[model samples]
Target chain A: AQSVTQLDSQVPVFEEAPVELRCNYSSSVSVYLFWYVQYPNQGLQLLLKYLSGSTLVKGINGFEAEFNKSQTSFHLRKPSVHISDTAEYFCAVIPVYNTDKLIFGTGTRLQVFP
Target chain B: DTAVSQTPKYLVTQMGNDKSIKCEQNLGHDTMYWYKQDSKKFLKIMFSYNNKELIINETVPNRFSPKSPDKAHLNLHINSLELGDSAVYFCASSQVVTGDNYGYTFGSGTRLTVV
Candidate 1:
Protein backbone atom coordinates (compact mmCIF):
# COMPACT_ATOMS: atom_id res chain seq x y z
CA ALA A 1 0.00 0.00 0.00
CA GLN A 2 1.12 3.54 -0.76
CA SER A 3 0.23 6.76 1.03
CA VAL A 4 0.93 10.43 0.34
CA THR A 5 1.40 13.15 2.92
CA GLN A 6 1.08 16.87 2.33
CA LEU A 7 2.34 18.64 5.46
CA ASP A 8 0.76 22.01 4.95
CA SER A 9 -3.01 22.33 4.80
CA GLN A 10 -2.92 25.98 3.88
CA VAL A 11 -0.19 28.22 2.52
CA PRO A 12 -0.47 31.99 2.13
CA VAL A 13 1.95 33.80 -0.09
CA PHE A 14 2.13 37.25 -1.64
CA GLU A 15 1.98 37.85 -5.37
CA GLU A 16 5.36 37.78 -7.08
CA ALA A 17 6.87 35.97 -4.12
CA PRO A 18 8.24 32.47 -4.08
CA VAL A 19 6.34 29.55 -2.62
CA GLU A 20 6.89 25.91 -1.79
CA LEU A 21 4.46 23.11 -1.00
CA ARG A 22 5.86 20.07 0.75
CA CYS A 23 4.84 16.53 -0.19
CA ASN A 24 6.14 13.16 0.90
CA TYR A 25 5.19 9.59 0.13
CA SER A 26 5.60 6.09 1.53
CA SER A 27 5.70 3.05 -0.68
CA SER A 28 7.56 -0.24 -0.77
CA VAL A 29 8.32 -0.07 -4.50
CA SER A 30 9.04 2.62 -7.01
CA VAL A 31 6.20 5.09 -7.58
CA TYR A 32 5.16 7.94 -9.86
CA LEU A 33 4.65 11.36 -8.31
CA PHE A 34 2.26 13.98 -9.56
CA TRP A 35 0.95 17.41 -8.67
CA TYR A 36 -2.59 18.44 -9.60
CA VAL A 37 -4.28 21.82 -9.30
CA GLN A 38 -7.99 22.26 -8.59
CA TYR A 39 -9.64 25.58 -9.16
CA PRO A 40 -12.87 26.53 -7.45
CA ASN A 41 -15.81 24.43 -8.67
CA GLN A 42 -13.63 22.58 -11.17
CA GLY A 43 -11.91 19.27 -11.64
CA LEU A 44 -8.24 18.72 -11.08
CA GLN A 45 -5.64 19.62 -13.73
CA LEU A 46 -2.20 18.06 -13.90
CA LEU A 47 0.46 20.52 -12.90
CA LEU A 48 3.58 18.36 -13.11
CA LYS A 49 4.97 14.86 -12.58
CA TYR A 50 8.17 13.07 -11.64
CA LEU A 51 8.55 9.79 -13.48
CA SER A 52 12.27 9.23 -13.84
CA GLY A 53 15.52 10.86 -14.94
CA SER A 54 16.38 14.31 -13.50
CA THR A 55 15.33 15.14 -10.00
CA LEU A 56 13.96 18.55 -11.02
CA VAL A 57 10.76 18.56 -13.09
CA LYS A 58 9.19 21.69 -14.57
CA GLY A 59 5.54 22.13 -15.34
CA ILE A 60 2.90 24.57 -16.56
CA ASN A 61 2.51 28.05 -15.01
CA GLY A 62 6.12 28.11 -13.97
CA PHE A 63 5.66 25.36 -11.39
CA GLU A 64 8.44 22.92 -10.66
CA ALA A 65 9.15 20.05 -8.27
CA GLU A 66 12.25 18.27 -7.06
CA PHE A 67 12.27 14.57 -6.34
CA ASN A 68 14.48 13.36 -3.52
CA LYS A 69 14.67 9.62 -3.20
CA SER A 70 16.46 9.60 0.11
CA GLN A 71 13.85 11.76 1.80
CA THR A 72 10.92 10.33 -0.14
CA SER A 73 9.96 13.89 -0.91
CA PHE A 74 8.62 15.62 -4.01
CA HIS A 75 8.28 19.26 -3.08
CA LEU A 76 6.58 21.71 -5.46
CA ARG A 77 8.04 25.16 -5.94
CA LYS A 78 7.38 28.33 -7.88
CA PRO A 79 9.68 31.28 -8.24
CA SER A 80 6.92 33.80 -8.60
CA VAL A 81 3.22 33.27 -8.03
CA HIS A 82 0.26 35.20 -9.37
CA ILE A 83 -3.23 35.82 -8.09
CA SER A 84 -4.49 33.29 -10.60
CA ASP A 85 -2.18 30.71 -9.07
CA THR A 86 -4.31 30.53 -5.98
CA ALA A 87 -5.91 27.12 -5.94
CA GLU A 88 -6.04 23.79 -4.12
CA TYR A 89 -3.02 21.65 -4.98
CA PHE A 90 -2.95 17.91 -4.50
CA CYS A 91 0.00 15.55 -4.40
CA ALA A 92 -0.59 12.03 -5.61
CA VAL A 93 1.40 8.83 -6.07
CA ILE A 94 0.97 5.56 -7.97
CA PRO A 95 3.06 2.51 -7.32
CA VAL A 96 5.04 1.48 -10.39
CA TYR A 97 4.46 -2.25 -10.30
CA ASN A 98 1.15 -2.32 -8.47
CA THR A 99 -2.43 -1.35 -9.31
CA ASP A 100 -3.38 1.65 -11.43
CA LYS A 101 -4.96 3.30 -8.42
CA LEU A 102 -3.57 6.63 -7.26
CA ILE A 103 -3.00 7.58 -3.63
CA PHE A 104 -3.62 11.25 -2.97
CA GLY A 105 -2.71 13.58 -0.16
CA THR A 106 -5.19 15.62 1.82
CA GLY A 107 -4.41 18.72 -0.31
CA THR A 108 -2.86 22.14 0.22
CA ARG A 109 -4.80 25.33 -0.27
CA LEU A 110 -2.61 28.00 -1.85
CA GLN A 111 -3.80 31.54 -1.30
CA VAL A 112 -1.87 34.07 -3.35
CA PHE A 113 -2.48 37.49 -1.80
CA PRO A 114 -1.86 40.78 -3.55
CA ASP B 1 -12.38 20.48 -26.74
CA THR B 2 -12.97 18.71 -23.45
CA ALA B 3 -11.05 15.49 -23.14
CA VAL B 4 -13.30 14.08 -20.46
CA SER B 5 -16.86 15.28 -19.95
CA GLN B 6 -19.49 14.53 -17.29
CA THR B 7 -23.15 15.44 -17.57
CA PRO B 8 -25.35 17.25 -15.03
CA LYS B 9 -22.71 19.58 -13.75
CA TYR B 10 -24.81 20.20 -10.66
CA LEU B 11 -27.34 17.79 -9.18
CA VAL B 12 -29.63 18.46 -6.24
CA THR B 13 -31.81 15.58 -5.20
CA GLN B 14 -33.81 14.60 -2.15
CA MET B 15 -32.74 11.84 0.21
CA GLY B 16 -33.65 8.22 -0.59
CA ASN B 17 -33.92 9.19 -4.27
CA ASP B 18 -31.95 7.58 -7.06
CA LYS B 19 -29.81 9.41 -9.62
CA SER B 20 -27.20 8.80 -12.22
CA ILE B 21 -24.26 10.81 -13.53
CA LYS B 22 -22.95 10.12 -17.02
CA CYS B 23 -19.33 10.40 -18.10
CA GLU B 24 -17.66 10.22 -21.51
CA GLN B 25 -14.07 10.62 -22.58
CA ASN B 26 -12.93 11.75 -26.02
CA LEU B 27 -9.26 10.99 -25.43
CA GLY B 28 -9.63 7.38 -26.61
CA HIS B 29 -7.96 6.14 -23.47
CA ASP B 30 -8.40 2.54 -22.40
CA THR B 31 -9.08 3.20 -18.74
CA MET B 32 -11.63 5.37 -16.93
CA TYR B 33 -12.14 6.08 -13.25
CA TRP B 34 -14.59 7.68 -10.85
CA TYR B 35 -13.43 9.68 -7.87
CA LYS B 36 -15.34 11.41 -5.10
CA GLN B 37 -14.27 14.62 -3.41
CA ASP B 38 -15.98 15.33 -0.14
CA SER B 39 -16.56 18.65 1.65
CA LYS B 40 -13.09 18.38 3.12
CA LYS B 41 -11.70 18.31 -0.45
CA PHE B 42 -10.28 14.82 -0.04
CA LEU B 43 -10.32 12.95 -3.32
CA LYS B 44 -10.83 9.19 -3.18
CA ILE B 45 -11.13 6.67 -5.96
CA MET B 46 -14.47 4.94 -6.14
CA PHE B 47 -14.13 2.64 -9.10
CA SER B 48 -12.02 2.00 -12.20
CA TYR B 49 -12.82 0.32 -15.51
CA ASN B 50 -10.40 -0.79 -18.16
CA ASN B 51 -11.72 -1.71 -21.59
CA LYS B 52 -15.23 -2.10 -20.21
CA GLU B 53 -14.03 -4.47 -17.50
CA LEU B 54 -14.22 -3.78 -13.80
CA ILE B 55 -10.65 -3.60 -12.54
CA ILE B 56 -10.62 -1.61 -9.32
CA ASN B 57 -13.39 -1.33 -6.78
CA GLU B 58 -12.51 0.48 -3.62
CA THR B 59 -14.20 0.42 -0.22
CA VAL B 60 -17.18 2.36 -1.52
CA PRO B 61 -20.58 1.31 -0.28
CA ASN B 62 -22.70 -1.09 -2.32
CA ARG B 63 -25.17 1.70 -2.95
CA PHE B 64 -22.82 3.05 -5.64
CA SER B 65 -22.70 1.26 -8.96
CA PRO B 66 -20.58 2.06 -12.02
CA LYS B 67 -21.55 0.98 -15.50
CA SER B 68 -19.40 1.13 -18.60
CA PRO B 69 -21.23 0.69 -21.90
CA ASP B 70 -18.00 1.04 -23.83
CA LYS B 71 -14.47 2.23 -23.46
CA ALA B 72 -15.48 5.84 -23.98
CA HIS B 73 -18.33 6.05 -21.52
CA LEU B 74 -18.65 5.23 -17.81
CA ASN B 75 -21.75 6.07 -15.85
CA LEU B 76 -22.32 6.04 -12.11
CA HIS B 77 -25.69 5.25 -10.55
CA ILE B 78 -26.54 5.75 -6.92
CA ASN B 79 -29.25 3.46 -5.63
CA SER B 80 -30.32 5.30 -2.49
CA LEU B 81 -28.94 8.76 -2.14
CA GLU B 82 -27.85 9.83 1.31
CA LEU B 83 -26.49 13.02 2.76
CA GLY B 84 -23.01 11.48 2.98
CA ASP B 85 -23.13 10.93 -0.78
CA SER B 86 -23.16 14.64 -1.46
CA ALA B 87 -19.86 15.63 -2.96
CA VAL B 88 -18.09 16.48 -6.20
CA TYR B 89 -17.75 13.47 -8.46
CA PHE B 90 -15.08 13.57 -11.14
CA CYS B 91 -14.43 11.26 -14.07
CA ALA B 92 -10.91 10.82 -15.37
CA SER B 93 -9.03 8.88 -18.04
CA SER B 94 -5.49 7.68 -18.36
CA GLN B 95 -3.41 5.78 -20.90
CA VAL B 96 -0.68 4.26 -18.79
CA VAL B 97 -1.48 1.69 -16.16
CA THR B 98 1.27 2.71 -13.80
CA GLY B 99 4.54 4.59 -13.39
CA ASP B 100 5.73 7.98 -14.67
CA ASN B 101 4.04 10.05 -17.37
CA TYR B 102 0.87 8.16 -16.53
CA GLY B 103 -1.26 11.08 -15.52
CA TYR B 104 -5.03 11.45 -15.75
CA THR B 105 -7.17 13.99 -17.59
CA PHE B 106 -10.16 14.97 -15.46
CA GLY B 107 -13.63 16.15 -16.34
CA SER B 108 -15.30 19.35 -15.17
CA GLY B 109 -16.84 17.41 -12.21
CA THR B 110 -20.43 16.98 -11.07
CA ARG B 111 -21.54 18.49 -7.79
CA LEU B 112 -24.14 16.23 -6.18
CA THR B 113 -26.18 17.58 -3.33
CA VAL B 114 -28.48 15.29 -1.36
CA VAL B 115 -31.07 17.28 0.51
Candidate 2:
Protein backbone atom coordinates (compact mmCIF):
# COMPACT_ATOMS: atom_id res chain seq x y z
CA ALA A 1 0.00 0.00 0.00
CA GLN A 2 1.15 3.57 -0.70
CA SER A 3 -0.03 6.97 0.43
CA VAL A 4 0.96 10.63 0.04
CA THR A 5 0.75 13.57 2.36
CA GLN A 6 1.09 17.20 1.35
CA LEU A 7 2.14 19.11 4.49
CA ASP A 8 0.73 22.48 3.60
CA SER A 9 -2.94 22.91 2.88
CA GLN A 10 -2.44 26.49 1.77
CA VAL A 11 0.60 28.63 0.99
CA PRO A 12 0.58 32.39 0.54
CA VAL A 13 3.55 34.00 -1.10
CA PHE A 14 4.48 37.27 -2.79
CA GLU A 15 5.30 37.51 -6.45
CA GLU A 16 8.88 36.64 -7.40
CA ALA A 17 9.44 35.04 -4.00
CA PRO A 18 10.73 31.55 -3.64
CA VAL A 19 8.39 28.90 -2.30
CA GLU A 20 8.31 25.28 -1.38
CA LEU A 21 5.45 22.83 -1.00
CA ARG A 22 6.29 19.84 1.12
CA CYS A 23 5.17 16.28 0.35
CA ASN A 24 5.92 12.94 1.93
CA TYR A 25 4.86 9.40 1.23
CA SER A 26 4.67 6.03 2.97
CA SER A 27 5.14 2.87 0.98
CA SER A 28 6.25 -0.66 1.71
CA VAL A 29 8.22 -0.91 -1.54
CA SER A 30 9.79 1.13 -4.27
CA VAL A 31 7.44 3.71 -5.82
CA TYR A 32 7.14 6.38 -8.51
CA LEU A 33 6.46 9.95 -7.47
CA PHE A 34 4.67 12.73 -9.31
CA TRP A 35 3.67 16.35 -8.85
CA TYR A 36 0.58 17.71 -10.57
CA VAL A 37 -0.92 21.16 -10.77
CA GLN A 38 -4.55 22.07 -11.30
CA TYR A 39 -5.85 25.44 -12.32
CA PRO A 40 -9.22 26.74 -11.14
CA ASN A 41 -12.01 24.36 -12.19
CA GLN A 42 -9.61 22.49 -14.48
CA GLY A 43 -8.15 19.02 -14.72
CA LEU A 44 -4.87 18.06 -13.18
CA GLN A 45 -1.72 18.52 -15.25
CA LEU A 46 1.50 16.64 -14.65
CA LEU A 47 4.28 18.92 -13.60
CA LEU A 48 7.00 16.31 -13.16
CA LYS A 49 7.60 12.74 -12.10
CA TYR A 50 10.37 10.70 -10.49
CA LEU A 51 10.58 7.14 -11.71
CA SER A 52 14.29 6.65 -11.04
CA GLY A 53 17.79 8.03 -11.58
CA SER A 54 18.61 11.53 -10.30
CA THR A 55 16.99 12.67 -7.11
CA LEU A 56 16.37 16.15 -8.43
CA VAL A 57 13.67 16.55 -11.07
CA LYS A 58 12.70 19.68 -12.99
CA GLY A 59 9.30 20.34 -14.46
CA ILE A 60 7.47 22.74 -16.69
CA ASN A 61 6.64 26.32 -15.67
CA GLY A 62 9.93 26.68 -13.77
CA PHE A 63 9.04 24.18 -11.06
CA GLU A 64 11.30 21.54 -9.53
CA ALA A 65 11.25 18.84 -6.87
CA GLU A 66 13.85 16.85 -5.00
CA PHE A 67 13.37 13.27 -3.95
CA ASN A 68 14.77 12.50 -0.52
CA LYS A 69 14.88 8.79 0.10
CA SER A 70 15.95 9.17 3.67
CA GLN A 71 13.07 11.47 4.52
CA THR A 72 10.59 9.83 2.18
CA SER A 73 9.72 13.19 0.74
CA PHE A 74 9.41 14.84 -2.68
CA HIS A 75 9.01 18.52 -2.01
CA LEU A 76 8.27 20.92 -4.85
CA ARG A 77 10.27 24.14 -5.15
CA LYS A 78 10.39 27.16 -7.35
CA PRO A 79 12.99 29.90 -7.21
CA SER A 80 10.40 32.52 -8.02
CA VAL A 81 6.65 32.41 -8.15
CA HIS A 82 4.29 34.38 -10.32
CA ILE A 83 0.65 35.22 -9.93
CA SER A 84 -0.07 32.77 -12.69
CA ASP A 85 1.53 30.08 -10.58
CA THR A 86 -1.30 30.23 -8.12
CA ALA A 87 -3.01 26.90 -8.28
CA GLU A 88 -3.66 23.66 -6.42
CA TYR A 89 -0.71 21.27 -6.39
CA PHE A 90 -0.97 17.59 -5.67
CA CYS A 91 1.60 14.94 -4.82
CA ALA A 92 0.93 11.41 -5.95
CA VAL A 93 2.56 8.00 -5.85
CA ILE A 94 2.32 4.66 -7.67
CA PRO A 95 3.94 1.52 -6.38
CA VAL A 96 6.75 0.20 -8.54
CA TYR A 97 6.23 -3.20 -10.16
CA ASN A 98 2.66 -3.12 -8.90
CA THR A 99 -0.43 -2.64 -11.00
CA ASP A 100 -2.04 0.04 -8.87
CA LYS A 101 -3.70 3.31 -9.57
CA LEU A 102 -2.11 6.61 -8.62
CA ILE A 103 -2.72 7.70 -5.02
CA PHE A 104 -2.82 11.45 -4.58
CA GLY A 105 -2.41 13.67 -1.56
CA THR A 106 -4.89 16.20 -0.23
CA GLY A 107 -3.33 18.92 -2.39
CA THR A 108 -1.77 22.27 -1.49
CA ARG A 109 -3.17 25.52 -2.74
CA LEU A 110 -0.48 27.99 -3.78
CA GLN A 111 -1.67 31.55 -3.59
CA VAL A 112 0.74 33.96 -5.25
CA PHE A 113 0.11 37.59 -4.43
CA PRO A 114 1.16 40.71 -6.22
CA ASP B 1 -7.42 17.95 -31.04
CA THR B 2 -8.32 17.14 -27.47
CA ALA B 3 -6.66 14.09 -26.01
CA VAL B 4 -9.33 13.47 -23.40
CA SER B 5 -12.83 14.88 -23.33
CA GLN B 6 -15.84 14.43 -21.02
CA THR B 7 -19.39 15.60 -21.47
CA PRO B 8 -21.61 17.64 -19.10
CA LYS B 9 -18.96 20.03 -17.89
CA TYR B 10 -21.42 21.26 -15.27
CA LEU B 11 -24.31 19.11 -14.16
CA VAL B 12 -26.98 20.17 -11.70
CA THR B 13 -29.48 17.62 -10.54
CA GLN B 14 -31.74 16.85 -7.62
CA MET B 15 -31.49 14.00 -5.21
CA GLY B 16 -32.64 10.54 -6.35
CA ASN B 17 -32.08 11.53 -9.96
CA ASP B 18 -30.03 9.45 -12.37
CA LYS B 19 -27.40 10.86 -14.72
CA SER B 20 -24.53 9.72 -16.86
CA ILE B 21 -21.27 11.34 -17.93
CA LYS B 22 -19.56 10.29 -21.13
CA CYS B 23 -15.81 10.31 -21.74
CA GLU B 24 -13.85 9.90 -24.97
CA GLN B 25 -10.12 9.96 -25.60
CA ASN B 26 -8.15 10.39 -28.80
CA LEU B 27 -4.76 9.46 -27.35
CA GLY B 28 -4.95 5.91 -28.70
CA HIS B 29 -4.17 4.65 -25.25
CA ASP B 30 -5.25 1.28 -23.97
CA THR B 31 -6.12 2.32 -20.43
CA MET B 32 -8.58 4.84 -19.09
CA TYR B 33 -9.53 5.86 -15.55
CA TRP B 34 -12.20 7.69 -13.60
CA TYR B 35 -11.32 9.84 -10.63
CA LYS B 36 -13.33 11.87 -8.18
CA GLN B 37 -12.23 15.06 -6.46
CA ASP B 38 -14.25 16.06 -3.46
CA SER B 39 -14.89 19.58 -2.24
CA LYS B 40 -11.82 19.23 -0.04
CA LYS B 41 -9.70 18.87 -3.19
CA PHE B 42 -8.75 15.31 -2.47
CA LEU B 43 -8.57 13.09 -5.54
CA LYS B 44 -9.39 9.39 -5.42
CA ILE B 45 -9.46 6.79 -8.13
CA MET B 46 -12.86 5.26 -8.66
CA PHE B 47 -12.40 3.00 -11.67
CA SER B 48 -9.98 2.01 -14.42
CA TYR B 49 -10.49 0.24 -17.73
CA ASN B 50 -7.91 -1.28 -20.06
CA ASN B 51 -8.74 -2.56 -23.50
CA LYS B 52 -12.40 -2.16 -22.67
CA GLU B 53 -12.01 -4.50 -19.73
CA LEU B 54 -12.61 -3.65 -16.14
CA ILE B 55 -9.29 -3.53 -14.34
CA ILE B 56 -9.58 -1.57 -11.10
CA ASN B 57 -12.67 -0.77 -9.12
CA GLU B 58 -12.32 1.04 -5.85
CA THR B 59 -14.65 1.16 -2.85
CA VAL B 60 -17.17 3.35 -4.57
CA PRO B 61 -20.85 2.94 -3.79
CA ASN B 62 -23.03 0.62 -5.84
CA ARG B 63 -24.88 3.60 -7.22
CA PHE B 64 -21.87 4.44 -9.36
CA SER B 65 -21.14 2.33 -12.40
CA PRO B 66 -18.52 2.55 -15.15
CA LYS B 67 -18.89 1.24 -18.66
CA SER B 68 -16.28 1.07 -21.38
CA PRO B 69 -17.80 0.27 -24.74
CA ASP B 70 -14.40 0.45 -26.42
CA LYS B 71 -10.80 1.24 -25.65
CA ALA B 72 -11.29 4.90 -26.50
CA HIS B 73 -14.51 5.53 -24.65
CA LEU B 74 -15.49 5.19 -20.99
CA ASN B 75 -18.70 6.31 -19.42
CA LEU B 76 -19.90 6.76 -15.84
CA HIS B 77 -23.44 6.47 -14.63
CA ILE B 78 -24.94 7.23 -11.26
CA ASN B 79 -28.19 5.81 -9.99
CA SER B 80 -30.24 7.41 -7.22
CA LEU B 81 -27.63 10.02 -6.47
CA GLU B 82 -27.30 11.59 -3.07
CA LEU B 83 -26.05 14.93 -1.87
CA GLY B 84 -22.72 13.44 -0.90
CA ASP B 85 -22.24 12.32 -4.48
CA SER B 86 -21.44 15.84 -5.56
CA ALA B 87 -17.90 16.08 -6.81
CA VAL B 88 -15.67 16.84 -9.76
CA TYR B 89 -15.23 13.80 -11.98
CA PHE B 90 -12.17 13.52 -14.19
CA CYS B 91 -11.57 11.17 -17.10
CA ALA B 92 -8.00 10.25 -17.98
CA SER B 93 -6.20 8.00 -20.46
CA SER B 94 -2.75 6.43 -20.51
CA GLN B 95 -0.76 3.79 -22.32
CA VAL B 96 -0.34 0.37 -20.75
CA VAL B 97 2.55 -1.11 -22.74
CA THR B 98 5.17 1.01 -20.99
CA GLY B 99 6.25 0.60 -17.40
CA ASP B 100 5.06 4.04 -16.45
CA ASN B 101 1.52 3.77 -17.75
CA TYR B 102 0.95 6.45 -15.14
CA GLY B 103 1.38 9.11 -17.77
CA TYR B 104 -2.26 10.22 -17.88
CA THR B 105 -3.95 12.88 -19.97
CA PHE B 106 -6.92 14.26 -18.07
CA GLY B 107 -10.19 15.75 -19.19
CA SER B 108 -11.39 19.17 -18.11
CA GLY B 109 -13.70 17.52 -15.55
CA THR B 110 -17.43 17.26 -15.01
CA ARG B 111 -18.59 19.15 -11.99
CA LEU B 112 -21.64 17.34 -10.69
CA THR B 113 -23.79 19.06 -8.13
CA VAL B 114 -26.54 17.12 -6.42
CA VAL B 115 -29.05 19.00 -4.35
Residue A57, candidate 2: C-alpha displacement in angstroms: 0.8
Candidate 1, clashing residue pairs? none
Q: Candidate 1 on B38-85: residue-level lDDT in tens?
A: 999999999999999999999999999999999999999998899999
Recovered native contacts, candidate 2: 0.71
Task: State in Å the error of residue A67, model 2.
Answer: 1.0
Per-candidate iRMSD: 1.7, 1.9
Write the residue-wise lDDT of candidate 2 on B1-42 in tens digits: 989999989999999999999999998998899999999999
Q: List candidate 1 segments past 4 Å from native.
A: B97-101
TM-score of chain A of each: 0.98, 0.98
Best by DockQ: 1
In model 2, how well does chain A match by TM-score?
0.98
- Candidate 1, CAPRI quality class derived from DockQ: medium
Ten contiguous residues minimizing lDDT sum, candidate 2 chain B = B95-104
Which residue ranges in model 2 land beyond 4 Å of their true spot? Answer: B97-102
